[model samples]
Target: MEMSELTALLTPEGLRLLDALGTVETTDAAARAVSTLRAAGHGPDLVAAVVGQAHLRAKARTKFGEFASRMLFTRAGLEQATRLSVAARHAGRLRTAGITHVADLGCGIGGDSLAFAGAGLRVTAVDADEITAALTAFNLAPFGDDATVLHSTAETADLTGIDAVWLDPARRTAGHSETRRVAATDYSPSLDWAFDLATRMPVGIKLGPGHDRDQLPAESEAQWVSVDGSVVELVLWSGALARPGVHRAAMVVRGGHTHELTAPADSEDAPVRELGAFLHEPDGAVIRARLIGDVARHLEAGMLDEHIAYLTSDAALTSPFVQSFRVREVLPVTPKAISAALRAGEIGTLEIKKRGVDIDPATFRKKLTLRGPNAATLILARVGSKRHAILADRVDAA
Candidate 1:
């Protein structure tokens, strides 16, 4: 949302209209709402703002749940905001540390701030962008005096009264609607500054899950989190927020339940062996946290290939940390041969999962010309020196 649109939306009239409008999720609904509102003598800017917000609120339910209905968003802010479930976990760390006040630097749309305040802690939320800060203030207005919203850069935010820091630096270009990711070196309130702050205070630093591990501070606890199979973010905890003797952590959240795997440091890879009855694809968080060996031992598994992350086990075991697949049979890697095998199996829908290969699953799925009354997952991988396609049935996580 632009400053002009935001200015119009701040009016009492605009907020009421946005709430009354419900959800304009479809293009047709948005268009119709705009026309009807304009026809009712509403200004174009107000009409646009409320309609846009309605769409964003509907989409944001995936992250903020019902809170989004009463909140506002910028396309970029919503994209970068942490999920409520994950943010609550972050707040739990602060609560456990007995920190009562938190300074949330770069508080995009106040997502984490909401979690903090909801946990009964006072929140000081800061954002560099003026429009975002204003929107954040409005979103957090419900918390009243408990939440302080600031339109200041992280460097300028006063933290004297704070107990801990939650710094999520802007990792994208400055914009309301359309924005692109900036390089790590270009992050606002640079990582260097953030890490320096970490050394002195209890801090939780959120970064992209794929952040260079070697660049992370040696003393901090690095944790990778995934939600329902999608790796979300990497968090570095220092001071009171860091767990003792725990250096690498993988937190997997599925169906609102969480299971965590932690190690003192990255674990060595399990020895390689031939394909077994079950193939385990470790969760992305597990792979990124470099604790695959811990999970491997838990399942009595070995690396399918020395250089790949896929694991194989003769034991019929599965864990929350991996998506286990019952390997049916290995088929030839050639497109024609693989398609023939799939067709003979009566496969109608295929899920292609690949690692250590250069094939695009979408294009390859089309080439396979799937047809029939069955669905199966195809595992494309390099085992030893050769590439192979393994037909498999997904074994739901226990």
Candidate 2:
């Protein structure tokens, strides 16, 4: 649907119709609401506004009903909702680290702040956008009056004496669509300013997983969090907030159960193993935690390479941080040979995963004309080089 049509369906009359209908669950409800508003002779603009507003409100409520706060509707704000599990895990870590108060810098729509308050920490939430700050107040209103929302950039925001600070730098411009021209340094509350704030307060900053390692401070602990096997966000913690090291953790919440994969700080010994019947690739978090070696040791498996993170064995192994898959076949990396092998086996549909391979999955899929069979192949590469493909059946762990 056009944005204009969407806006027209979001009018006062449209909102009234929606409210009268209670909550929207079907497209028919949306269509009927639009039809009713249009029949009532409501202008297109009001209709559109009401529809848009309802959609946003419904989305916010659906995603964040557990916490109360206003919506910022920014890219970063959306990312927060998407990474809620990661935020909650980070909050748990902070609680363990003895942080009872948090100064949430750039608190767009109060995403992380909600998690902080949910963790029972006092929060002083700050944002640069006036509307966002107001929305933050509204979103945080349901927390039973313990959260304070502020409208100001971190540079000028008063953060003195707060136990911890959460910083998420704005990565977009006001106009919204000109991101190609926007720069990270252009944030009103710059990273330099955030770093300075970290020195005085326990600070946890949310950054893109692809952020430069050089940009990270030498004394900070950097964590990469993934949910359901998908890497989502990278968190940086200062000494005041956490101990120094490269920490990687998978924040898994399955069926109301929560688990994490963390490497012990003291264990540096790698795993030793002889060839086994199956190889297990540790989860990203376990790899990031630098504990795959420990996991290998725990499983009595050998590393394919000291630097490479893949573990191999002839015996069955059990670990939370890795998935065990039985090797069906191994082949040298070649387009024609791989394609012929796939075609000869009548394998039509395939999932190609590569770690060290230089070929893009999309490009390889196109080149091989893969289709017909249901199978998944893992393309392991050298530590820094790409390895050939390993066609395998995923071992059901549970």
Best prediction by TM-score? 1
Residues 76-109, candidate 2, lDDT per residue (tens digit)? 4554543455567678878998988888888877
Weakest 10 consecutive residues of candidate 1 by summed lDDT: 362-371
What number of backbone clashes does candidate 1 have, counting pairs of residues 3 or more apart or in separate chains? 0
- What ranges in model 2 sit over 4 Å off? 1-39, 43-45, 57-76, 80-82, 175-188, 243-257, 263-276, 288-291, 305-309, 334-349, 360-387
lDDT of 1 at 18: 95
lDDT (Cα, tens digit) per residue for candidate 1, span 51-162: 9999989899999998888889988899999999999999998999999999999998999999999999999999999999999999889899999999999998899989
* Per-residue lDDT of 306 in model 1: 85
